[model samples]
Target: MNEEVGSLHERLARLEQLLTAAQRKPAEPAWRRPTSRESRWAVSAAVLGAVALQLLLPERLAFHPEWLLPALELLLLVLLFPGPRARKRRTTSLLRGGGLTLAGTVSVANGWSAVLLIRGLVRGSEGSDARTLLTAAAAIWLTNVIVFALWYWEWDRGGPVARAEGIADYPDFLFPQMQSRELTQADWEPAFADYLYVSFTNATAFSPTDTMPLSRWAKLLMGVQALISLLILALVVARSVNIFGG
Candidate 1:
């Protein structure tokens, strides 16, 4: 009886050891990293904020229209330019990064134009007529449209190329050949092709898994922008109708 009991105890211990070893095995890597949905949300929020600020704030509080426009323009330029040094510093896929940079530029330009128009309206200038206000709104809307289009285009190109090549799809590493290596376009083709592939792929797929912090921040930005735009639009329309008699 004693021998049998000892054998049972030993067998149980071995089974537990095997289970622990199995549990320690590393998980398989993901086939593809997730997209940055948080970033998209953040961008959307920023756009909404620009619109809201134009619409809601009293002309007095939101003064300095010129400053916002130029600042945004500068930001766009920095983001879009893919100098060799930048490529080395950040391993983002070339095409997607460039596309994003272009989108940022377009957004800033459009936003600045809107700000100028709003400034005119607040200043009570003749240029602040209904026609101008409408034009400004249209321009802002166009900026969003352009950005969306660019995003989609990049996404379309990036997806298939990554899969076909069996390479990691992260933008930072995928499109090195598209960038300027030493202040020349000589190496642009290969880099550009790789970039296009990554951008297209990422656009279609959700950004690789990101922490909740980024996602929340993006949502917050979107909400702020949306609120600002809605308020500004409302005020502008109301003021315009009052001045012009419908």
Candidate 2:
């Protein structure tokens, strides 16, 4: 009886050890390092371009100050760019947080502006020209694409830099290339371009195409993005028909 009890405790201890080992993530290899930086230029350009497009939208669809949202977005861009080498320095976290916050704010502003544009168009355009309305719609659609791309770029394992660092063991998105070793280098990490593709595909299809979301937040974000895109597409179509018919 004594021997059996001792053996059972030993087995339990061994099981716990295995479980702990499984829970712990392996350290990133020395040769395979995460990129300290991401596509700052591309993302910055996208933000600036989106701001420019927003400027083209009618005054009624814009924020009260007209320049408020764009000005704030541009300020974030200035903070993000022309800085000391943040990637190699201690300011990495601050820079990353700033970028993420900027993207989220711009997304909310653009999304809200888009809702206003759609509402105006659906409600007899409020005496606005069809051409101007459609142009604003196009700009809003492009802004939607850019904003969500920024969101995906900023997120997914806690942004590109963190992902490259391998700080987060879990993947929020599972891409096909991630599965095939031959498709990429052994130390390959997804970049802003990959996330951009994920966003574009998701927006177009209104669902996951090549990449699958893994986490609850990931799934929810994607679903919300799809819903917004659908509403935009539907409203645009309905308004277009009304414009031609009347």
Per-candidate TM vs. native? 0.40, 0.81
RMSD of 1: 13.3
TM-score of candidate 2 relative to the true fold: 0.81
Give the per-residue lDDT of model 2 (tens digit) for 71-187: 989998998785435556457777778888888878877877877876775676542466776687788888888888888877888876677677776788887767786877777
Model 1: per-residue Cα lDDT over 1-246, one tens digit each: 999999999999999999999989674223243322112333334444444444443343333564564456445544544332332324445635654665565455555555665665566652346775665555454444444434433343253234223344333232332233455343132223333333333323323112111234333533444454554566677667867884
Candidate 2: RMSD to truth: 6.4
Candidates in order have lDDT scores of 0.45, 0.79
All candidates: CA RMSD (Å): 13.3, 6.4
> How many residue pairs clash in model 1?
38
Name the weakest run of 10 consecutive residues (lDDT summed) in model 1.
Answer: 205-214
